[model samples]
Target: MKEALKSFFGLDDESDDDELLSKNLNDDIAIDPDFVMSTDMLLAAIMEAYRVMDRDKDALDLFLTKYEHMHENESLRLMSEKKKKDPSLSSMHSSKEEDKQRLVQSANEALRTFFKMNNDEDARLLFRSLNDSSRTAETYIIMVGGLVEKEPWSGEISQLYQSAVQSKCLTEELAFLAMKSVVFSKLDGKMRVLRDIIADTSSVLNISPEEFNSSRYWQLKRTLGYRFAKLLMWWRNLSSSWEKELKLSVRQLKQGRQGGHVIDEDALRCIVKFAGHNQRDDINQGVPVSDGPSEKDQVIQNKERKYGIKLIREVVVDAHQTTLYNSPAFVDDVAIGFCSLKAYDECIKFVKEMHSRDLIKLKQSTYEHAIYAAEEKKDLKMVDELIRNMEDGCSLNIK
Candidate 1:
């Protein structure tokens, strides 16, 4: 037995098995021998070899690889046997909460070992196998935490995040946890992923702009506006020849009647903010006059002829136009003042014109708002028309 053990371990007969075994014991000897090793002698021999080589990692990896495959094969065999016994048994076992928990736990253990080995490629593959949400979440939490701990505030950690996003199997909780892990890393790539996720149209837009501003996504948001503006500003700033032509286009567009249409705070801000001026007073700030024509109209016309577009204004308009435009500043005032005053014709007229001009881009909430406003006014005709127009517009846009 001693000679067989010595040959198995590649150790000399004089070497003490007890001393070597004691040295080879992991800090926590919790793993079952039946699970970690195929036979008692193999376990002792492997441990002895590990002690001789001082290769704890290698031993641990070999043990884990065998353990994982054993469980996986066992699981498959159990599933196959259950299926043969009763096809419904397969479904039953899958649905069993305890089985689900065990699968999740096993997956997590595999992931932990993969990460410990620093085999990122295999770790990612193992993560992909974990399709259950609970298991995926567990794996990501461990992986992300390990990444942050191992390479805190480093670009290498960001690669893991990019991998998660690219995985397509990642859940929101996993994505958020991965994001939170590298929050302090200031990785541009990770920040870009977070921004893209938050901005995903498929998901409900629950992440507010304010929330975006609070997170690492804030840097992205700041640069987004500037980047968008830069495309137009590039030629204007770089080439003197394009400047005059660009100015001409602006003047013509402004002077045109189309200028009065499609005005919103953001669009207006973009126009005015980019069209630089030396003084704040140079920016015409007030509610835009939507009532019967006034001097402001002529000013708009002149500016349009000069710049070729009606520039965005900071002015507050009447509640009627405000509500029509869905401007928040005017939303409450329009609700309280116009609806109570029963200015139904004025409201209906504004809606009809705005709808015809494609000025009021109705979102789900906006459509509901218009319907409620029309109902309160008791103008069934306006409500019906508004609904029809919204439906048609939305359908056309979708198509």
Candidate 2:
């Protein structure tokens, strides 16, 4: 080991100049991978010993300890700067702080390269080599993060996200960061990331019903809803029919492997709107594809309308089956979605049906949608009836 160290640093041990050489090597400016022990050689030796001894963690810990040692003094300088009160001391140590950051960053880069995470296939193989690899999240985050940088919206990103959540290695902060990355992926117009993240919603966002009232929750829901709408459009373009697209999109929304856990009403309504709009659009423009249909079929277009109604009903029924139906926004958003979809009769019918079911403590938006739908239909009597219903429900006696 001593001879190997000497050969690594081009040392002349016979000259009794060991102390001089060691001092020169230790100096901050001279400290580098080559003058110090060759990290490559050290790593190879450690790995060989580890393989023979049948150890993985110990070898990694050994490499980490040695590699991190190179930055220890610089890191300590940063801590000292943080603790010091004197302005002069802070100013004097600014350069040292920068150096410390650089040292730490360099160490991380070196670790990434050493672990072969800079190459995706190798990184994946390394993860798979571990038993119950998904639970190895703590060890694999940095490596996977580097891999994600190369392919932000790939199947691998979603897999890593799901694994990280499954492994319980995801902190709240990391969870939001990953979600934000998915939202930002849309700037590149990648719908797959949006769909994948939504598919992993229970793991990715995972907030409870209690926090539903918070502005942050609504904000996140709105952002997700908007993205879902865009994704709905993309799905529509990909499929031959709205039913196929809606089914595929619903499949994407299911939670865990069992396909339970419905998405909340706010985001679900976004999907509903797109499904209905395609029906309206197809009716207006004639069937996009030829299918043994007359002009009467175009006018009657009941298949698209029926499929839209079925899709929306399925979403609402799933919510009712789950605890999310109790959310106050549920009835309101569903009504608004129906109105937005121009299913005026369906919108009014939903309101009456929900009231009959007594499942809702109706919000003002529900009445507003009912009234708006009546007005659009030029049904004065229905408008008056909705106004009285709103007064009885929420005292919104609007003129």
Worst 10 residues of 2 by lDDT: 283-292
Model 1 segments more than 4 A misplaced: 1-100, 141-194, 200-205, 215-399
Worst 10 residues of 1 by lDDT: 278-287
Which residue runs of candidate 2 sit more than 4 Å off their true CA positions?
1-248, 251-267, 279-294, 322-330, 340-345, 353-365, 372-382, 396-399
lDDT of 1 by residue, 273-317 (tens): 323222122222311223226887666544532331223222223
Q: Estimate each model's TM-score.
A: 0.29, 0.35
Using TM-score, give the best candidate's number: 2
Quality of model 2 by C-alpha lDDT: 0.51
Tens digit of per-residue lDDT, candidate 2, span 1-399: 434433432333453223322332224433233343344344445444543454433333333434344356446667777877645666546644443333332233333443542344544543553344223334445555565445554456656676766776665434444555565453565455544444454344565322321313434445455434434344345344445434445544454115565554444544554555544434222112232268776655556656666667777777766655665566676676666556688888888776556455677778788788888899999999888877776742232
